[model samples]
Target: MTANTSKSTEGAHEPGGFGALRRLHLSYAGEVQGVGFRWASKLTAERVGCTGWVRNEPDGTVTQELQGTPDQIATYFGAFSRVFAAHPIEYVIAEKSDISPIEDERLFTVRF
Candidate 1:
């Protein structure tokens, strides 16, 4: 499915139901810590109607698990890339997970 590639100007809201869910496990390598990555993700996720959590990994890499419709997920990804690029960073490796049928949730949060 084609994902929304636009930057969010509206408040993100779930599209409802569990249809074509995309669960993504994103990993940012190189200088990802102590740069407010999690906060940016949480904010952007809300703008994209995403449900999940973003947090810092113990291994220095930033990690986040996102669950939502494929389109909304796409927008979330776009927002992440925009936010990541907006701030100076080393490198980002956003890896999509093999998980399927993501749970339907209405909020995105920052994991402590």
Candidate 2:
């Protein structure tokens, strides 16, 4: 896990200020690829006001790097998990790592 060096004073609940932002690297395995996981993750991140990217790995995993407040990040994950559960996509959290937050992120996107 990288150190949290965010200097922004914006609170997590604030509209534009990503208060106490953090970055997370997450990988999902087991039927994650080709299951609309990346698209669903992108939607969840956008809805939660997170900035980062998700992609499909060649090893049949779905990998994503997301940046947001702790609560927002949790919410994003919850949303994704709910979708997976409802649809039964065989998704499993394989790994997670905390990373240094990028200071100037403006939007969440999906990377191919």
Candidate 3:
């Protein structure tokens, strides 16, 4: 999919203000399926206070939509990267781009 870098003003008036809040649609390829990647993502999202959903695609990739403050998302990725470094599974961010944050999204989930 093509990347869209446009920013959204949907969350600008929220409690913590805007610009810092971000939502991203991401597709991960490689040894991502059946490798605990979704669980890791769920845990990381929780740890970083993010709200999103992750699922495995039929094409042997993983897709996730993550939402949080910029810092939180960074921290989530940093932690996930560390996990990857310790494991044999390799992954690439096949696609990632800004998306509109969902209002009242309170929890991260793993889709079956």
Q: lDDT of all the models against the reference? A: 0.67, 0.75, 0.80
Top-scoring candidate (lDDT)? 3
Clashing pairs in model 2, backbone N/Cα/C closer than 3 A: none
Higher-TM-score candidate of 2 and 3: 3
Writing each residue's lDDT as its tens digit, candidate 1 over 2-50 gives 2222333233334453455666666666776787778888888888777
For model 2 the local lDDT of residue 57 reads 85
lDDT of 1: 0.67
lDDT of 2 by residue, 1-112 (tens): 1222223333223344546778777787777777787888888889888999998888888788889887898798677667766667655667777677888998888887
Q: What's model 3's TM-score?
A: 0.81
Models ranked on lDDT:
3, 2, 1
Off by over 4 Å in 1: 1-19, 84-86, 101-104
Q: Which candidate model has the greater TM-score, 1 or 2?
A: 2
Off by over 4 Å in 3: 1-19
Root-mean-square deviation of each candidate, in angstroms?
8.2, 7.2, 4.5
- Which has the greatest TM-score? 3
Give lDDT for model 2.
Answer: 0.75
RMSD of 3: 4.5
Backbone clash total, candidate 3: 0
lDDT of 3 by residue, 1-112 (tens): 1223344444343445444667888888888888899998999899889999999999998999999887788798888777756666867788777777887899999999
